[model samples]
Target: MDSYEKLSYVSITPHAEFLRNFVANTICHSCKTSQRKRCINMADDHNLCSECYKTAVFSIERLPYIVHNLRKFYRQFNLKVDKNIPIFLTDKVEMRKEFDDKTTHSMTVYAKKSTTLVIKNCLWQGEKMEAVKEPKKLSKISILLRFGYPDVITGARLAHEMMNVWLGNKGCMDIQQNIKEGICKVMAYKWLDWYFCNYVDSSSDNGRLGLRYIQIYKPEIESNRAFRGAKMAVDKYGLKHTLKHIVNTRNLPDVNQATALVKIMNEPNEINTVLLAQEEMVEQRTSRKMGLIFS
Candidate 1:
């Protein structure tokens, strides 16, 4: 299997040269240098060359078909991709599947590494779901917003990367299948928070941590101080059960105040006002409940 293409920015593929001679009168709106083989024609008078057109169309439009073909390819070949193997997209393709039996053909997906055939309890081999349609109109910004920046790669090329890399051919453990099958709940900002939580070790240089725990916490941890206070509380209390304590005890709405509170929490000698408030609130609540029960 050819190594899959991994693109960080969008550009024209060399194969696009084959497509250029066939197209007439259309110029690539993106690179102006390449004679566009096809125009995305996304909007009024707006057109992208063959490479840009494919990138925009395939990343969103051809995702389902590509996924279907990959599933079928895996099933027919009985190849096993290890759980830890890293996959990449390649320019090479060995097969093409149409969207249906009638209309013109769709995009082609590059094949992956081939090994000895071994049939296991495959997860994707089940009843097929109706294909989800990609919206006809999508801005470049929308594409970037939904799925990060577009690297110059064919939709089939990108599909190759997605299948081998993120989607990992782990039978039932496949994220592509899980997402398409609706087996796992998908959330927007959770991806962002997950990235930050794992990659970012500390708050930003200006003492700012952008809403790290906003999705889970009520009233939302919007400030750095509240986040630090929450962290301190998490160390003492816990994540799942500490929202009430953080919300009630520490309210650092101002950035400056939050910064100051963080300093307090860090110092061993100084009393952390937020932590003190939390402890006091817990004691007060406990006493009140005890008094009511006794009375």
Candidate 2:
């Protein structure tokens, strides 16, 4: 596959480019530039242009989404929690069948009250669910406010990254045929990425880590608003399971706060080229893995 246009995020490859040229030259990423210093991005391992290098060199801003991404990933994947989240605010949920094939399946969820969530499982050739449980509500926003932490927002790019990884993998066991789950994972990664990129990316002597010193720590509210809107799009598109996995647990080391941001990057690409043909059942049947003849 031509990685640049690949259907998966690993195919969405990152590159080291001249940073200033990117801002004035390209509008794809958020722009930040004035003084130049050469440095490298540690997480994705891309070289930073000189303007970006200075902030990392002079002050103490850290890399993006290292811990929160790792922690969120470990908890859902390793701990075996259902990363599918339906409605975060109310926590009520129900799950039902969407798609079923020998190699692929999908489910839906709905919420009731007091954050009560329901999940259903229907698969063609896979094992049946042992049971489903109502998920615990993430701590209330009021509590986080009392504790004086940044309110969690959706992590956009991180979720996209996870989705790409899940979908793009050559093996079915990698993330399984759980297409609904694949959506959830992508949501998580994107929400966190939005948080981290805003928190971690900047040029300043008194950096983002020292945010406590400032009376206001909301330079990124515009991005935050954008993310929330995208998240709402998820809700509108009927993907609540995705919203839950992407919300951050409260608490952070100041240096690692960007990790929390990784929980909800909050930006959804306008183009869903990867799943453009997903609605076409015939195309899905003719897909490489399964060769079922549709009725």
Candidate 3:
């Protein structure tokens, strides 16, 4: 897959087996049962026994609330758009066929130009005339999210795609693929962390389930070496500074350069000492490893 595509994987497990194993060790928040015939874990701090789970699943709809919350969460980033982008809950088959067999969770489509009629001026013989046959080039953005994912998973996918939208809107689409996708991954991971901290009740059963999901998802997002490196940059510098650097330079900040700058700044009078010390540390470590190999 192209690094720029920004794909996420989904894990599908049988509902029956999932429930059986889930309730085996964890207490159901709804029925307060550690041992139940069947139980299902849910997002938002609610684990339910078989009957309660069925009732909750059948009667309660959480997608709208999730979407609303996500929209609200996105606004906090301050990535403004001239208009609202449309989001559609779609099936996997409707998504790109290349990812059909790959268990793709969601995708954002950005079109450089959408079809629209525009007036064109022309001179017929001697007089000027207007023609309407030509089409104007206008950019379009839309999100296609596969239905049936758990609420939290759906939220994460939406968060990822929304970052894509933000990048496109900001005209950062021309940047290097690894760097662009790495930024998207960073945003998605940040959203997941924010969601867990602000929304999930860490003390509740649902909160525990949410944390487990975050643990599983975060590593997958960070699996890319570029993504990991980008995250390190964000950690060392602030997000605002990191983002500004990416936008201004169209590249990730050089780690070696940043480290040297930090050293120089911290010990301005001992710049040479710092450099020599760093070089000596590297040589000493290499010498110890070589000695171990020879011995």
Best candidate, TM-score: 3
RMSD of each: 20.7, 24.3, 17.9
Better of 1 and 3 by lDDT: 3
Query: Residue 259 in candidate 2 has what lDDT?
Result: 43
Candidate rank order under TM-score: 3, 2, 1
Candidate 2 lDDT over 94-171, as tens digits, reads: 211112232211122222233332222111111110112234443211000000012222123224334433332322
Better of 1 and 2 by lDDT: 1
lDDT of 2: 0.28
Predicted structure 1, TM vs. truth: 0.20
Off by over 4 Å in 2: 1-31, 34-51, 54-68, 73-159, 167-230, 236-295
RMSD of 1: 20.7
- Give the Cα-based TM-score of candidate 3 against the true structure: 0.56
Error of 3 at 159 (Å): 1.5
Ranking by lDDT: 3, 1, 2
TM per model?
0.20, 0.24, 0.56
lDDT, each prediction: 0.29, 0.28, 0.56
Superposed by TM-score, candidate 3 places the C-alpha of residue 60 at a distance from the truth, in angstroms, of 14
- The 10 consecutive residues of candidate 3 with the worst lDDT sum are 121-130
Error of 3 at 34 (Å): 18
